[model samples]
Target: MSYSRRKFIQQSSRGVAGIGLLGTSALGVSLGAGSGHTEIEPGAFNFGVASGDPRQDRVIIWSHFQPAGQHSTPVQWQVALDEGMMDVVAEGIFVTTEARGNTIKVDVSGLLPGTTYFYQFRVEQAFSEVGRTRTAPEGDIDLARFAVISCSSYAHGYFNVYRILSERDDLDGVLHLGDYIYEYGQDEYDERSLRNERTLTPTHELISLTDYRRRYALYRLDADLQAVHRQHPFITVWDDHEFANDAFQDGAENHNEGEGEWRDRKAAARQAYFEWMPIRENRAGGISRTLRYGDLLELIMLDTRIEGRVAQPGGVDRQSEAQDFNRTLMGFEQEAWLQQQLSGTTARWKVIGQQVMMAQRYYIKLPDLFGGGASLWLDSWDGYAATRDRLLGHIRDHGIDNVVVLTGDVHSSFAADLSDNPYDANNYDRNSGIGSLAVEFVTPSITSPGFPPVLAETGAATIMAASPHIKYAELRQHGFILLTLNRDEARADWFYVADVLKRSTQYRLACSFLTRDKENRLVSV
Candidate 1:
């Protein structure tokens, strides 16, 4: 058979098999980490184990195996109630092959709601590290907490933020907004010091299946990234950097003719992402889905960058004309699906976990020599104002309450109130937040560089002075946001790591903001 034909068959087979592989049997519900398991050999399961997309009764567990042998190998997996794996509630045998990059992703089901479980993989006499994961709670959950993070570029700096988050015991899961990986070459986007300190394997831009796979493998080698994946289940969505810089549907700003066909590169990136991440295999084959935490929250993850976005026009100065072209950020189908989710969910909080910022972000006006008035960051929602209006308008028209948007991609933290017109004094009161429809919390990057201190401070002050709806902005930080939800309100606490150039656990809370159950605004805590 041809290579393409063989690849399709392999992918199809793996997809069908992995979609809903339940545990073979339930041994018991007790707890302990049995000492009887064989000692692990070096470099057996090199990538480690991870679990994600937690429902009330099911979650996806993942591992990659690369042992010297034949193309196919039989692996045994088990889930227990204790860290020791002595309980053995779920056990199964999954056959992995080189065809699927030697990666194993099993959607384990029949789990208890709102409970913690330990899991591990075994290949012959060797055992992988045991991972900890939790399922979402069932009816009437009073509280939920998740670590929101994004933009981890390997060449930028150390992943100390991931390590810090891994050490925390208060999280229910993780929300990775986007840019989980970058596609730039080692020297393309980093400084000389950074390139020498943390070198990429390929040393060139990723454009093929082999290239993308090797890049992911290199990142998985990080102890901090592996530690977080071992401890918490992550719900993830992709942004531009996952494929290439400023990626749209048909092509990317970073992709060129010399890099092969855009569709081929895109397919390569998508395949490798599925193979590595612990997210559940979508039968429909798209990265947009909704996860519910009983009546507390409904997390609607979106594919804003590539699902169906029309390529942005040439310059940022043409924003006024682009608005007339009727562009879409999340496309039509995704927009309809999101509308349905927002209108139907009875949960107290309707959390939209997406890539770019949704609130209006217009820069300060320049001098006449530089074409005068405020120019928008065309990549964000400011470029697709109509879609933002439609979505926020739907919430207002249908009387939907408690809508919170979690975003990343600007490498800065922000708290803003979503409004129909923040600039119009009649529509919204900056101090009172009268006409606000929803709220947004943007998380800083894990390691990607943000603006310098002076520029960040001045830019933030200018934006806030003109746009009162923006409550907070901290641009020169590399950390994650701890988002806590409850019956009364939703609070987001921003924490900044002490240093990203070196691996350190030192971090401090920069600030915090919260919105009451019925109010669609942010209040400083």
Candidate 2:
């Protein structure tokens, strides 16, 4: 029942039109008399191929075709085990039209668990890029690995992060912790006014569905992003940028009456998000769902920006009303669902793939004698202190062990421990009835603003000096986190590119951390 990678490739090449024929150099084309590269027709899949929301024995395959002006057309898709695309395991035909943007999304099922499958779409004589995707493993499993990334602004230099990530063949998939595409338009932010040719599109902030669609169009045009999508599935969640900066359920900081109503804008952004990304619809509360990876890891993907988040609490509210403990970021329904899942789950590691930092960060500006302490950010969980305290209290009360929070939206890498005493980060010594309840790993931005000047302009030493819980902080890096989880331990390796300005650059592993099972601690590797 077990198949080695060698055996899989061997079986795949047994016949012509094999997996290798799908267009990659390694799998050169063996189809008839055409060149190894057969350019697709204009009215075909010009944006490449992708798959996501992979479950055991099931996965979602997505492709977009331009009918030019046609109303409806039939597109065919197939799953093959061989490089030649011969040995067809499953095949189907789907209908597409301008109404759905000539896009096709198919949920293919009846496949084997923990199995790799290659798929492609045929629009008449042309073929969409062959996509490689694997289903999630079921029951007990030995190991799983994935790349965690976030905050990719088209105007902020190149997505060399995608290029580097696509080179990886061992990863199970990708976990995007939001900011997949920013809402800011051309020349919106002074920091985003880079010299990159791939500037934000529409020349304006996305407030309409059409605007959001065109924005996604420009982002998908990047060959690096396309290559990554064709290579592996992406499990994603949205952050504030998808809608607007500092977004809550009611409104956003960027939206104004002059632009449009906040509710309509939020709806447009949400619709575009689900339409462009290869994501499945959640039961309720939108985009908040849990994924079980065998028995080793359970990824609890949380939607912290929208759904039912309250407006951020300001300093006045914090001092005047005690910050209102009832104000929530995850809402009530989602919190209850998460509690139920974590309290009873059997997975060895429960990971929250969420947007924004959850760990407590303090501000310690020298008095006005130096320069007034800079304003602190309240958009993160720090703004909802009481809600965070409630969640941590629940974990401690229930004895939830091996909990790990993977965060984004800050554009920096951090390894921190969540203390049992939420009030004291430095006093988590396990003697004063205070100890670490969980650990968190924050992945840096892919191509967002490089902090104030460059990643973590304040320096890691300065940041850690304020928030002592963080064991390591790489503030000046634009990269992603590579995570490997097994039965006994989980390791996170940070990889950063040499330069985002260049189309191609040298990317190297910056550092690694090891978290022993149930230890709730990070050790530099």
Candidate 3:
């Protein structure tokens, strides 16, 4: 958690003055005649820097600055094509204020596409460490790859997976598909079963903006997470846990009648999320945006939480109505935008980056079971069957080749082929046939319970037998996925962390999946 003295100077305003190494004394540097030699101590501002929403020519840069005595101050940012700072490409000033938790976000633009740039920030007389970022490629690009990650819970285990992922130099970008931070208070969830679990810093549930910001700050303190953010540009989307558990359009399952108004809580969560995370404001138009990697790939990042979720149900039977095709995760406007993007895209692959799984999953009928049939978690695509079907239909109708759905929130790894009908048990063709659409790869949680005791005890055979579209499923384990995209095929490597209870970094390849040209089917890798 210690930053270098040189890094601090580079990020300070003094370094902006182009001062050479002065005589080293008690203070790091000696100021000239009228200049003060006082140095700003590191750790004054803790939240690390991040970049996101990468486009062909632009990407957003972000940092949260906390001045020693003042609430916050304006920090100047400079982006140079070279490490020597001889080729200054873009520069801007971002004011960090308490209103936004001293967070600053700058959307730097007008740079050459598919190029790497070095950037730094200056506050008063101190400058920050130089960070590197890359812009997306222009039209008809040759190659692209990204790491797909999600569901990193502090209370559940260590972040060794992040540490390993951070060291990988092959990724062009990182796609975080939600559940980046958990809302649970300390000791609320049991982690004794985990291997390398660590308790959260605050030891309390975050409900306010400051609490959430602090949580993010703590998370960024992890060396691995910081390295990963520093290593590649990130593209993110939020799932329910970012706001509250099982958050619908109007309210959440965790919100109560007396726990303030739902709108206020939702707004607070959204405000905190924007303040801490690297995302554009949730404007009225939509949170869906397209990132084109030249002609190679088009990543469509969607907002599935706020737009069209229905109110919480009164009972189990009432939940059945939640599946009304009209009850959407993405409102009509966003859905239309997605459909249009899919239809109009000329990229080799159309990647849907969002929360929740798209595959149709159902419970198997077991004779003399304790509770008969299993309940489908109403929060997933299972509860929005009609909308899921519609999306698949759109992909099929548009003949979108290499359409892949990257999802999270289930806290389990799932590889499936998107089919028109996955529930027709007697339809052998439906079971074995690869649908007209593409594939889906679900990354497991950084640390979340999966498969539970009962399901794990059953050996996952029943679940696999029930859902044929689900080609693969692993109820246990925690890790991230590395996706390599080529002109002819897309490959996903499931990196499973050995333990989440302690701080170990051991991992193994749980599985791999690949999709090739002409054949939208996903073959086991």
lDDT agreement with native, every candidate: 0.81, 0.76, 0.70
lDDT of 3 by residue, 1-525 (tens): 221222223433212111111211211122121223223234243445678887777888877665654454778887787765556777878887667766778988787888988777778775565667888888666678888889888667667777777777777888999888887766665455544445454456766555565566557656567667766788888788777888878877777766678777677777777877777664663457888888878899988777676653347564455456677767777778889998898888888998888776667423323322233655676666567768878877767788888998888888988776655554324444545367899988877767666666465566677777777888777888888888898888898887776667788887899988657778887
Cα lDDT tens digits, model 2, 255-309, are 8879888988898888778777888875553998888888998989998899878
The C-alpha local distance difference test score for the whole of candidate 1 amounts to: 0.81
lDDT accuracy of residue 8 in candidate 1 = 8
Collision count of model 3: 25
Off by more than 4 A, model 2:
1-41, 192-197, 283-285, 318-322, 364-375, 420-427, 430-434, 452-459
Q: Number of the top candidate by TM-score?
A: 1
Off by over 4 Å in 3: 1-43, 84-86, 190-197, 312-314, 364-375, 425-432, 452-454, 457-459
Clashes of each: 1, 9, 25
Task: Please give the lDDT score for candidate 2.
Answer: 0.76
lDDT of 1 by residue, 33-69 (tens): 1312122222267666789999999989998766555
Q: Candidates 2 and 3: which is better by lDDT?
A: 2
TM-score list, all predictions = 0.89, 0.87, 0.86
Model 1 CA lDDT for position 302: 93
**At residue 521, what lDDT does model 3 achieve?**
74
